[model samples]
Target: MALNYDEIVGKFDKYIFNTYTRQPVAIKKACGAVVTDVNGKEYIDCVAGIAVNNVGHCHPAVVEAIKRQAEQLIHVSNLYYTEQQALLAEQLVNLTEMDRVFFCNSGAEAVEGALKLARKATGKKEFIAAEHAFHGRTRGALSVTHKEKYRKPFEPLAPAVFVPYDDADAIREAITEDTAGVILEAIQGEAGVIIPSDGYMKEVREICDETGTLLIVDEVQTGFGRTGKWFAREHSGIKPDIMTLAKAMGGGFPMGAMLAREDVAANFGRGDHASTFGGNALSCAAALANIEVIKKEKLVARSNEFGAYLMKKLKNLNKDYVKEIRGKGLMVGMELSIKCEDIVGKARERGVLLNCTSDSTLRFVPPLSITKEQLDRTVEVLDGI
Candidate 1:
């Protein structure tokens, strides 16, 4: 018999780690903003692989680039340089206005690198992060992550202080001479798209300058036009000492990077940090192609335009449970008076995949390439729900 969803899920139940709370559908293929399940069900993928598919799924350019690179050089050690890595690094440095780039395999790794770099540069061991912040799952990243449940299991992590988001005064009060850096998300993605107030980031930058502390901004979820800019920090017009990027960096391919200015980056010498498979030719090709698509298609502008459209449509929905609608670019979120897990399940059954984060927030991180018609359909499905 042909493979089915139940059989596949059964295999996962038996063999895979029970770490993720997965949805019921077993996706067979995805393209643009739609996914097809094993049972032949089609869905408007509002998740966009959790904001990874910025250029859309299996984009022809990204696919072709990966194929071409695989045919030439797929993997290479950091001891030696590959043209793909060189090209990609230069492109990243140019786009981010950073002096250097450190490649990694995931957002967690990027956060780890950024943390390590900040410590090395500042000769301090403590980090100050915002409450409800989520950097990643690794020990160092988790240390700064503000969720008690996630941190409780992984106790005795690194030293970090949690303060209120969008509150510069709390951060200033928390920082001490031992504070290596202040790590923050430009927009709190896992915390339900908590956008900072105007000048908050700039105020933090000034404080960091005054105290001689490094500022590390985690753009893992909001970068690559997720928030209508190449990076959300751009909106605040303040550059951090270090920045981490991932999610949409590779046109749906798994890749991450930590970037820093020349002076701050110079503290870490060669061999201080390295990733064996980081910036491998194959991943670099996908990332390079992904960036090209974002530029050629002007997805940043599209994200800004469509994001306003999506938020406007959502604000008009006749749902009493809606507490708030917020986001920048396509990274929209709807905070409900009730828990959103049930709403997510209901949305999935109706062909629009939704993500429920922070328990009560419905996060919409669809691809930047999604159409206005698709956007309308997504809202209509939610309205029906």
Candidate 2:
């Protein structure tokens, strides 16, 4: 049966929480790099659910894995052990070069867990975070997010000091003796794909070591091949003491995790922290399959190559409006001198999908499986817009 898109949207407006100002179109189906709306309008999905569908929508391996896991066992509470959960944890630990993994449900939850670990390990109350950093939406994560508009409503947040990004000296000044952790995104996602200065991460790593501050890298947007590397921090040749991952890690399923070194993870004993549905069998299966597909297809390397191509094409659009083109791999951003909301809407009307961040910046987080032709089409639409 076909869905009544307008009717459903109207009903949603009436009944749903007014949290998001949604786009008018209703996306009903997606495969590979394309999505079709309920009105039969097809689009080249450059957004990729803001980088969630790293293997593209419904890769056969992931779909089959989900089906098989659903038939076997959908979920088992954290009280009991499951093969899928253990296997996923082991795989993630190995992939992240970390000693332990804590499964949760979303990026915010993983950030929360990482925060808890850092405080417990260091026995400190304050934290240091980068300016324009976006960790998550929960209270603890929100405290460090750095954006005043999002934090104004919720005051008296955790004790976190904000330092200017890409500035090692600012970080040095911010990390006091009472600071438990220094957390930041490898590449600023919500702040419009801002990459750190050269050797910035190495400096951060060294400073954290000196201060006994746990370096927690938030890879929620840059992980799982979105930034062309297995993890964006690898591009800088630095390993964080703890890492928070979500988004593409579960292949569109709801799953988040924190990977930490053995010594740091020792802070949390049994009954210290737990989630009811964390590491469920089905989510674990999806994550394992997603990792397998990412490896088998060499999507990470492809992201690097194709991302260079896309950046080159975007540079050609450096007309009166575009101020800068910056990014790592498929996580590209175009900063405009003016607001980009209208341009994004115009591109969407022309059968291309994109998202805006920071109002004036346009973000392109295409699926890792996106082809050159799709990118060309997106470029053409953007050029016209």
Candidate 3:
């Protein structure tokens, strides 16, 4: 006899780490933008696995590559090189202006590696980050994350100062000779799709240039075509010294990369930094397929077009609860006059999935491959809500 879904969830509750407050639904399978729970309930997945499934769930290209690679090779230590890793690295370098790449297993690891490189390269300790920013959950990443609720228990985070986002004057005041880098998210995903003002990124670039401090952009959520462009920074017309990537890079498999200039990456030497499973052949193959699909399908352009349509439809809803709607490309947020969790629950019940950010903002980061017709259905659900 097979185990029932409730029994499986009960086992998970007893055995798994007690860190995350997971939703009650037991998702069993997913295709395109729809997810089915163990109980056979279907849902429209507007959250897109927290922006990880930019190309949609179980995309054929990514799945095929993974199947082929699994037969050829699965795991390899850093001692030996493989063609998949090389190809993926080349694709990442060509996709971005950064010189070299370092592969890791998760967004937090990428953030950790970037922080180490920045501090070692500049020989400084202190750093500056934005208020309401979330880099990752690692100790080093958390140190730069500014939420007191998240940081209070974990005292003595890495020495860093928090400054108001999109405020150039505040950023200038926060920086000093001791500051090694200025780390930020091009768009604050966890803080509710908070986009900085126009030219805000350019101003930060100029400031970093003047201060001789490395500029690190945490694109873990915004990278890999989530923001229409290949990268959110491309929209700003500014270049970062080091860019951290993860989330959608592996198309579901766990992977992350830090893109840095050649000179800065040389600080790691041979053994200074390493991940046992970084750039493993299987993940690299999946990532290569993922990037190819993004390019071949022009899903980035579709995200831009469909996202604009979605935003327009949402704006027309114009309910008194809506305080503001802000975003770029497919990364969008809606601020409400009241708490958004109730609305999120309502949307979920109506088969339109979404999540709230920091209490008041509703976040939408759907798959780039999502169709306009599907978005129309989502809007219909929203209208009823």
**Best lDDT goes to which candidate?**
1
Determine which window of 10 residues in candidate 3 has minimal summed lDDT: 1-10
Give the root-mean-square deviation of each candidate in angstroms.
0.8, 0.9, 1.1
| Candidate 2 lDDT by residue in tens digits, 113-203 | 9998898898898989989999989999998999998999999899999988899888888878899999989999999999998799999
- The list of candidate 1 runs beyond 4 A from truth reads none
Q: How far is candidate 2 from the true structure (C-alpha RMSD, Å)?
A: 0.9
Model-by-model lDDT, in order?
0.95, 0.92, 0.90
Give the alpha carbon lDDT tens digit for every residue of 242-262 in model 1: 999999999988999999999
Clashes of each: 0, 0, 0
Which regions of candidate 3 fall more than 4 Å away from where they truly are? none
lDDT of predicted model 2: 0.92
Q: Deviation in angstroms for 279 in model 3?
A: 0.7
lDDT of 1 at 118: 95
Report how far residue 21 has shifted in candidate 1, in Å.
Answer: 0.4
